[model samples]
Target: MIIMKAKIILILGIILSTALSSCVSIMTRTETDVHTISERDTIFSYEQKNAPGNQDMGIVYPSSRTFKSERRLYQRDSIVERKYPDFIRLGVFESVGLIGTVSGESSYGTGMFGIFPDFINLKSDYSGDSGKLFSGGIYRIGVGEWRLRWFRDAANWTIGTSMIEFLIPSAKKQNTLSSIFPLYIRKRYYLREEIPYIALVPSLGIGWYPSQYVNLSGSIDIGSLGGLNLRAYAGFAAGLNSQEAYQVRMSNESDKSHTSVFPYFGLGISFLDFVNIVPETYKEWKDHEHSSWNIGLIQASLIAAGADSSAVAQNSETKLFTGFIFKIANASVALPILNNQLYLGTSLANFVVLGFGEWGIGILPFRVGYWQTIIADELSTEPFIEYNYYPSNFLHIGNRVNLRISDFLNLGLVMGFASGETSMGIGSDITSQYGAPISFSRAYFGISVGVSDRIFFPDELRYNR
Candidate 1:
């Protein structure tokens, strides 16, 4: 009986030991689980605290840490607030081919031709000059603006400053050698989101220098897909100054009154407007993976004009013009069109040199074209000069093919037609008694080299996983 009681005591001891060990194990596991839950909660709370401000600021974060099920939720919560750009800066240079009419005139008649004529010579009834209308090319620049917009997709309204200078053929005989400064307001509207190549821009301003005038103008931009565009410009101006502004002379000395009115139209290449539909940073779409942007640091071209039978015979020789485009700040876009990848960009530069004698300094702001890669970063060719116009009326329409030597260097062969009226001896004169100054076109072949690089954006950066 005593041995049986001892056995019972041993069984009771075993049961108690087992129950105590289980309680210790359960306590340890509970502490560990609480610690893990606390860490997770801390991380989540921190993210929540920063997420609101980041969304408001349009700060995009990587989604690698997010689970698939939470993606939709995260995206909805992180929607960025849309805001308009703070300021929009504009720089454009234009060459105006104009015709003018003088109201109530004398021996020179009531017409004017060629940019800004020698009003004094015309009034004095100079001999060997029977032209009634003065027609010529004028230079203009638009710089600086205060811009307003409600959102990224909204239209832009701007108030800006502009300057216009009339090119007097005979500076010695002309009094209108000064520039007119104007304060203007403009409106620009985008026609479509998918196609940013078309737009309508209109402006109005009052200017004073050689004369006081109120001006109204508008332009339609077309086919700017690759940095080069065709611009149709029209404008009218009414002079506000007195008759003495133009020094008009009549049959009698007492009839010293003049009315100046100018209405003009021009068709030329312009690089004033460029909008990118496919930003380089947008890589979310599989098709956009190859899209890129670049800037050309230096560019050179060889141009030939007057290749046609009529132009060559009239000019007496085929003319060749060589130029270098330097200090370029441009915008480039890559697109897939016609089963090929095409790259286009604006060729805006600060200076240009044409041939040895003729060069333009200060804000040479227009050129656009496209090239196709023939051998993936090794060779590329552009078959046409969509539209390339530099300062003082150097227009180039041609084809170019390039061979890449390194990441930042390229050599190219160019051939095409060019047109310009220059007295610098680069080409023969094609001027006429009745037409505007220095108008000529010819065919050419040229070689070029440039330094360029692809532009990178913030979204291209990667986060460590």
Candidate 2:
């Protein structure tokens, strides 16, 4: 009974707390962040240009350096009129023993590309009664706040910010305040059963993105009047935690979900600008040597939290957090090992977007880093009695995308959730439970900058050159 009260209060707290927290313009934008596929599992880095597992150069002609390529070609082939097939390629049958993907979109290797600005939904629509909107009447999520959004050509300044804002419905039903007191007692309070309410958020943060592969930023937010929110980001950034699609034991799963925000630091490289390996004597319309097959890289990023835990448990019967936290609950309330320490993850944006782009819709895909858990804590106590946390491991999957609107800025969106159950049954010891997996997805928005000097490998570069 004690445990039930604690958990119930905790869940309700999340519902309430988010009301204020979600009010700050937030950024689901992690164009500069990384994630763990499992619980700190499959650690890796971001490979923006080349897909997963590819070699690194500086910049390929076909991929970028438009003006530079054009200049180079003009200077080299003095007899411009003699050139027939300007930007053309020959086949494997004509080359010397084809070994690697030495060709188009790497039929041999993985074609990779990362979302320009960490794809997210930057637009939203909400219409309904303000009272109802305030109490889960009608509303929408997925709007971010950006400060100093320096685009691909926002001068040579190093500053920017991105914020996300949403609704935190207050309780609407009045049954919550119903109470019957003893005849001897005579007292009545506000009869307060806070309704789920909506919030207007405007986050402000500063960003330092000297290069496309890096962005260091921080911000502070306020809501519910007293600046109820605070946030910051630096180095490699990613969500605080991956989301899970809520799946009822005997019902369908919820595809749209709210993902936790996690700030992190990064230290890695972007193969976006690969060094060109142009042939000695190239044939424009007939030479295939100048082709861009892949842009790959090996990178690493770090994530950490300082005293990132939950508010004191409503009554303390249940634990709140292990490492990081939200207003209501903590993710993995058992990470006693890491305190303000760093977690690692690899970014396969390059491979994901690029790989999917070839198929058409530019669908990006990524594996879980720490999304999988050996065991997720299970609830044992019931509203009737008992108290315990059962733990187990589970699996998760997710993806992200980049939607470019103009040259100066762009938007981004990402979604992911967990699958399978790593439950901790109420029975004696921790047990393994098997069932259909539960998954969650998040859609946010962001603005990308500095794409002027960039080019569309091979095709675009070839013609310009």
Candidate 3:
């Protein structure tokens, strides 16, 4: 629920920024080229400029009779009078470009924190295992303000940090023995990863300015994530001097990149200037930087020759495999392939959610063929896999749906039976499939809180939203 709130906030910020940017771009565009008036002499009204100043300006004016243009007049009787614009025009996106933006933030005080009790099931039988998800650890807090940046352009950077502490719901710790010595420890999942930590993020990116405040920013950020990233931090200020303009700032920094392609939405400031740096002026109103959210899905999957979640006994006689559930949270990475049609992604699924809490997250890095439409229609097959984390082996089959909503938001609902299995020697301390034997997994569901689509414009076609 907390993560969902943060997503809502960031999405809103992106929306606000896009809207404001579009307004500024249109408001600032030089609607009519000063063919008749030079910038140097533009100080006075075009009709009022004296001949000497116009002559000194050395700018040439097009002959009104020679230039071709649509007469703005609503054709009435023979005579014509141009119609005045009802309102300014705002730019819209055509194809897709990138934008980059940066921000600085600071919280007022210690910040907002809260807690709630919940239920957790670690065993296959949900009834017997359902326990206090947080017998005592139920605690959450919104840390200090964090600085953020949106990388859309070629040269964009962002840096932000927030101090946060997580009281991971405490559950009954498994005990060794009472006869030998009273000993109990927290579950490996909640213990190893839970701690009072600080979120750190810094990134660099560059994108094309499709419009003032509308940048299709493509950024690569490396940062820490903690306590549902506080929704957002925003500011509004006004400036009229040459150095400033009335501006509003919005920013975002998600360490987890939803799609390897376009995954970040940063800021939107309105009522300012417009320029493309390159093709500085296309001299076309059609070159609009679409400032809208795309709610779409990423239909893709992965096949890996890797160690499964199940471990193999090096002795051959018996495998004293470590009993830990592979985390499926951060095992997949969004690969925005060509036409934004293909995505190269990997997500780990566990048949059983054990003490270690079925650890996993999406991962990137795939062959170009995996991303390209090498396979037609995506086959519409149910793709699935089972990992033996111990020996580092996997038996994968079928096809899976990459149901993504926002550009980075995805919900992986996998339902299928595995048809094959392969094994590999485990390299100690692997991020996945470390020391467990492969478990045959049936239909499984992985819930994700980050972006997941190659194209960020799904909302245009899919959502009632």
Error of 3 at 45 (Å): 37
Best by TM-score: 1
How well is each residue in 309-387 modelled by candidate 2, as lDDT tens digits?
Answer: 2122222443322111011010111111222011122222211110100100111222212221111221111010111
Better of 1 and 3 by TM-score: 1
Model 1: worst 10 consecutive residues (lDDT sum): 425-434
TM-score of model 2 vs. true structure: 0.16
**What order do candidates take by lDDT, descending?**
1, 3, 2
Residue-level lDDT tens digits of model 3 in 1-465: 434654795586456445543443323334442223222212222233334433433677653333233333232233332222121111111011111111112101111111111112322122212221112221111111211223343221212111111111112111000011111111001111211112222322121111111112121211111101111111111111111111111112222211111122222111111112112133233332322121112232222212223232223433233122222222222223333333333322232221121222111111111222222322122233433332222333333444444334444433333322224322223323333323333333332222323222322211212
RMSD of each: 28.8, 31.2, 23.7
- Which candidate model has the greater lDDT, 1 or 2? 1
Better of 1 and 3 by lDDT: 1
lDDT of 1 by residue, 355-450 (tens): 333333323334445655576646667654434332245565566677777645567776766555433222111122112233545455667665
Q: What is the full ranking by TM-score, best candidate first?
A: 1, 3, 2
Clashes counted in candidate 1 amount to: 20
Provide the TM-score for each candidate, comma-separated: 0.40, 0.16, 0.24
